[model samples]
Target: MTQATHRPASWSVVATVRASAPVCNLFARHYLARGARQVFLFHDDASVACNVALHGVRNTVCQGRWWRRGRPDALEDRQVHNATKAKAWCETDWLLHCDVDELIWSAQDVGEVLGLIPDDVGGIVINTAEAVYAAPPSQHTMFRTPFFKFFFDERGRPRAYRAISQQAYGDLWNASKYGLWGHILGKSFIRAKADVGRMPLHHKKQERINGFLMRQQAPQLVLRHYDTLSPEMWKEKHLRRIRSEVSVPMAGRFRERQQALIAEAEARDGNAGLDQLYLRMSTLPPGILAECLTEGFVRVIRPEAHLLAQDHS
Candidate 1:
């Protein structure tokens, strides 16, 4: 058996979760195994301490009273806090800011992705695509109702949208401006360096343009977001966020949205529908869900493709 070789890269990963979730722990293990040198997990809730202890993973814990004057303002505070920690602790030349629910996959090995970064570039903008469900029943899995493409900026506000790609070579993000009503001012800037090259960060909606004050690149890599998986997990995460003293305005809005989604899912196929969505998802070919939601129709790289090739050979 060939041993997996770890390639040194300039980037590190940072994530923050208020209450502990099983999915978050799974993501941490996956990233750590994939060659991320450093991983930082931040939580303000003391209850999460017990959960973290069970995992036996060493992490930095930030304990304090968390409160938000309003919903929108509170969401931004969390972002700022995480960014502040990343700036303080991450020693890598580049930083990838992501949440536990978001998973970034590369067909090429990790080293291949790192090799693409140029020497002169400050940051890369990644394109994000929201995955949708095509009807049917499955067990344990939840499907995305085809609502809006991630690129459709007008459908949803930007703050709710998370970034899978963020570089932290020189100037780190200033967390104070996160979730502020105005434009993202002074938050997404990196120091210019001779080694930085033209790289793009892909979000579900827009591509960050290259050479401009803010550089964006649309790489072939994909970020699969499993935001609506498992009703129990979803409910637990949202309820915790909504109950938080800091999550006031946004929490209320989130609750409304959650209720609506639940109603819609139940009405569509009943409890059976939810069950089918989950079960079918466990068996569906890879990337099929994402393909259904893309604007221009693209071929999904299904797991069956590999199986078929082997069978033919």
Candidate 2:
């Protein structure tokens, strides 16, 4: 077995969690193992954050009735709050701004990935590959576990995944290559915090709020995002955001999709229809993962992860 090369102690990650507390810990653990020196997690559940071994900022940022109501603004509020705090807390040379479910994967230690940004650059936009999975091993298993990933973007056909129940592993496909929100890449890290006004939910810098634009998109560094991890998880998450801010004035494909999903699901078979939609979306498994390597849907983890070292499940 090969070990990862030594990494610089100049990187830290900042993440915010609403209900995915355990997964946040999983995120922290994986990043730390991957080379990030420190990880700060902000959440509403103090008890849940307490058990996780990282800089736990419990209830400090994620607290509010908005999350309970499912306000989209709540996500913005939590991210901005933690992004600022991370700027203050991060003594490292650079800080990673990403969500709990969006884990950035790199072939080399992340220090190498961050090095791609020239000294004049404030940040780098990392390409994202949505990690595809199958109907989770069970509800007991966490969302987007690496073991089940096989493809990215949209390959196969809708019928392929819908057919998983009958055929465990045949041809799971993805149809879309772009993100639901339109942009496929997102700014995941920033070395210059002084010019940053606030962390925007989707991208970095938030327009011209920052004086200079030193951010460039790096195709080599990729972020594995479980945005719509599963129908059950997606429903639970977005429903809260919808409920919290049905009138929050945000308009986009994400919001529109959530609205339609909530309405259609409720009117149809409760959440059953939504669950099936997700199950169909997540039809790829390890067998297809090998093929994805050839097609560029996913990349193999570089030194591989010590799966048994820290069990966040």
Could you tally the backbone clashes for each prediction? 43, 11
Q: Estimate the TM-score of every prediction.
A: 0.54, 0.70
lDDT of each residue in 1-313, candidate 2, tens digit only? 1232334427777777654545665677677777887777777445444446465322344556535745344445657666776778777777777777777776666787666454545556665555555444332243336632322334432223232322332222222323122235464577645476665455664432344444566655667766665566677665765666323343455456555655666678876776665565555555655565454444444324443444564
Name model 2 segments beyond 4 Å from true: 1-9, 44-51, 55-73, 137-183, 192-194, 205-213, 245-251, 284-303, 307-310
Model 2 root mean square deviation, Cα atoms: 7.4
Top of the candidates by TM-score: 2
Lowest lDDT 10-residue stretch of candidate 2: 172-181
Per-residue lDDT tens digits of candidate 1, residues 92-179? Answer: 6555556555545556655456545554445555434333344431212232222212432333244332231111101111221121
**What RMSD does model 1 have?**
12.6
The TM-score of predicted model 2 comes to 0.70
Q: Give the distance in Å from residue 244's predicted Cα in candidate 2 to where it truly belongs.
A: 3.5
Worst lDDT run of 10 residues, candidate 1, spans: 164-173
